[model samples]
Target chain A: MNFVHTMETFVEGKKKILLILLAVFLIALPYMLNSQYLVTVAVKIGSYTLLALGLNVLTGYTGLVSLGHAGFVAIGAYTSSLCAVKLGMNFFASMILGMVVAGLAGVLLGLPTMRVTGTYLSIITLGFGEIIKMIAMNWSSVTNGTLGVKNIPRPSIFGYDLTIANNGLYYLMLVLVLITTLFCIAVVKSKTGRAFQAIRADELASTMMGINITSYKILSFVISACICALGGALYASLIGYIDPNTFNFDVSTLILSIVILGGMGTIRGMFVGAAILIAFPEVSRFLMEYRFVLYGVILVLMMRFRPQGIMGWKSTMPYRLSKNVKEQVEKMDKNAPLNLLNETKG
Target chain B: MAEKEVLLKVDNITKRFGGIVAVDHVSCTVRKGEVVSIIGPNGAGKTTVFNMLTGVYEVDEGEIIFNGNPIHNKDPKEIVAAGISRTFQNIRLFSDLRVIENVLIGAHIKTKYNFFQSVFRTKKFREEEDKKTAEAIQLLKSIGLDYRRDDYASNLPYGEQRKLEITRAIATGAQLILLDEPAAGMNPQESAELMEFINKLKDQGYTILMIEHDMSVVMNVSDRIYVIDHGKPIAEGLPEEIANNPKVIEAYLGGVQNDAEDQ
Candidate 1:
């Protein structure tokens, strides 16, 4: 009993130890170096990671080729920032509001697109994204007509203001990334997750088996939109500003490229894609103008040669055992001393 | 036997595809616990009748009522939901999915899960999913493919694929099953096995509707047979009666051939 307890504690400790180290390093980072430029770039990477993760859910799991993800992000940032600054709403409240609005927009896009697929679906979604970006740029009363939302307030926790400078915004972005990743992992293993995979595998056959493919695909779009919107709101808050030019069709294309690069329909691949693409631009500062061109080249090569991406679609994770094996493991764990730890964990 | 209760009624159903009338005023009834066959020459509208009954294509000018509810215009999924299921002529399994997953998908008609509950793996959802997989396995076991449950569906051989397709339809909790040429490509021995297997399926409380061109299979397993000629049911009754019907003989052997031979 004591041995099992020690093993459980050791396994649990190793996972959180890194998180604790990350938090401590962040708190001490600015004081040690006081590098404003590094902090700004790091925060930006975190924000973009959130956006890529959102796009991954669609392009990855459901095989939905979306070129309109950045549109949802733009809507989120503009709606939430305008609400907080113009309507006197709290930052968190407006974030939720932005998510709902973006999600509704996703449904509108997904509903008419229920029958469209492959190249046609992509063209339609791209048009939807472009139209939203145009609306954001031209709408004067709500979005300030190309000036973008400005002077958005920083979120305060327990009377402490976390600003974009000095890694305060960097930590906030990291926390949001963590939350979103966990939520996505949970969702991908659920029944709806299987449905998305089923639809991706085959739709006509899926319908014959009584799967409601339309509902599941729309749900994928909705969740993808919500994730993008949440990231957009957080990005606006962290940067303390927004602009139409910042999130456009190009951003949507870049995010989608990350999904393909990471291997669509995979959670771990999302992180790999996010890490590489988010850091790619800043890392290649010397050739900044050609970075996007290089990105396109690499993406095309990968898709042409290694279409499965880094992790591959089929999971090698021992934890992703079949349901029957999983049940057997749970049964054994229950009888063994591991039940106490298992019950509290998953 | 004819004593079994009638479960599905197809009345004067006519289906036209552009310029051609595929099924012209076809009428039939599927009795509870009986295996019925629709046998005819190619393009005789046998498969078309199966399609209409299973809600794949709508009847242009007739009604298909299942358990006394009009089901001709209903979506195939809704019809499956109403306790009916089917298999296609060319195997239409989800090729990339596992064998068990294919069967489990068919059981979706009886599965209970709201979207959010399934997405979050709530208690009820997990319970229902576990129950479904078990049922799927049991169905697979009956078809003798339980050991290969985790294998990809496309990897299964032609005969095994046909068996799996039937197993999947059985898992749908369907009282009536429509099979379009279930043994189209099987060898004689495999066809014999299919005939026995289908009879067993009927014994297990499934009302079977199938279209088969193989006369041996048609006569061996079918309790009743419907023969169509130029998109109309020219003869329908027991296998013996259908075989002896002058119209059925004319349709299969041709009256013109008989006249020319006599001259």
Candidate 2:
């Protein structure tokens, strides 16, 4: 057990250093690469990572298999775009509003549909994604219908416009991604994280242990929705356009695939999952029309062989590999009234 | 036994399975610091009564008051919070987890640390964790499995699993521990150990309510016995007194006593 702890921390240390190196490389990446096409793909992949990270929280950690993440993303994109286009709110603030709206939607959806488990849950989510897409397509009053919100303004931070091809947006996105990643890692390591796993393991047992299963499960959905929403907000801003097609069911499927393929319930796994899911299609663009086919084949192979996903929670941990460690993954549940009362007042 | 200072009181408890009554109009009391056993033949609703008392099933028509607080029909979490926890007939464990981890989870209700604190293991959290670990390890040692702390619970063979189940219930900080058919799968020697373990818990000030089919185990460990036939308790008294009761013999063997024992 002590060895396990040591290994986890060591791996985390290595990962921290690697992340630093990756950030540095990204900062210098556009300069080194002559192809503007490659730089553009890199940015898209970066944005997709956030979506995958968010979806991973729902699918992997909390074990609430959602296929409606794209719906949340669409909600985010429209909310932020509408805020910028009509409400005249600043870009970052609009994105925050977008996330809040998405989170609230998650809570509402989670309340009614949380009873859906396993395959039933998947079907419901699938239907939900379609419904959301239909609404986005038909709702002209708020969304401008299928014509979509075009001429979306660039996000200007401190009156500095985030112009395309390596600008302040790159650093902003990277910094936010890093922060969100850290937040995710923290959440997964906490007590609620354990309760989420315990519910996944056995809802009956978890409930018997005094864990408020419903709260934690809904919390997972809200967090996941917020993250996906943030991704959408950024995506629309970066592209400076929006359409019902921009938030398609394919994006949701892609996000789900990244979480599953990366390793369900792993914070670090999201990075790996997101990278593969986002980059795979763009990387295989040379195959032109067959790119999606190649992507499907890759996904099929991954599911068949490594169903646990690339960076599964255990594998991605800064620790030694143990057999079926998920079975022993701890249970952290309940509220601390003492801590709450002790907290300093504003 | 109004004057008996009841520690637990069940008033008109009934449990029905669709159309059949499993526990019918059953009400009983467990006095403080007493060792009580619910003994009956197979499917006599003894375990059902235990389940109801432990808050596993909602009572059809009764109130369960523990330490004078009404606890019937509450969620199992609330029941546990009210200081009642149990061991299953067949051990239900997070089998793949380490022995220490299993107990740690059982002790989850008492850990005051927040989620963030547990992850970062803030000094306060670490202190609390160390205290919990020490307490859990102490319990493991008490049950003679401290050395197996790191081993997977499922790897401990049959008897140890039973022991682990008891230790887990104990770890819950429960004042009242319900043991359902705890000695069902154990050999004579293991049963003897469990008998001693029961006494040890009693000595530590836990009130035990156990269900047992093994007559010798019940006779040896229980200070009192409640013998149920069908869904109703036909007799409740000291084990020796219940053993000699005419109704108990008929319930166990149907009318005539066997061989020379009858005379």
Highest TM-score scorer: 1
lDDT of each: 0.78, 0.77
Predicted candidate 2 versus true structure: per-residue lDDT over A1-346, tens digit per residue: 4665677778677988877887788787777764667666666777888998898878876678888789999988999999999888998899999999999988877775447678887787787778888998998998899999988888887888875554566666777788788778767654566566667766666666666777778888888889888989988988888889988878888888888888887776777877777778777878999998888898899889888887652332322212223222333222212111112111
Give residue B175's error in model 2 in angstroms.
Answer: 1.1
lDDT of 1 by residue, B19-78 (tens): 999999999899887889988878899878877766668879989888888999888789
Ten contiguous residues minimizing lDDT sum, candidate 2 chain A: A337-346
- Work out the iRMS of candidate 1: 10.3
- Lowest lDDT 10-mer window, candidate 1 chain B? B254-263
Tens-digit per-residue lDDT, A20-55, candidate 1: 886787667666657777677667667777787788
Runs in model 2 deviating more than 4 A are A1-35, A113-116, A313-346, B1-5, B54-56, B95-104, B113-165, B183-196, B214-220, B241-256, B259-263
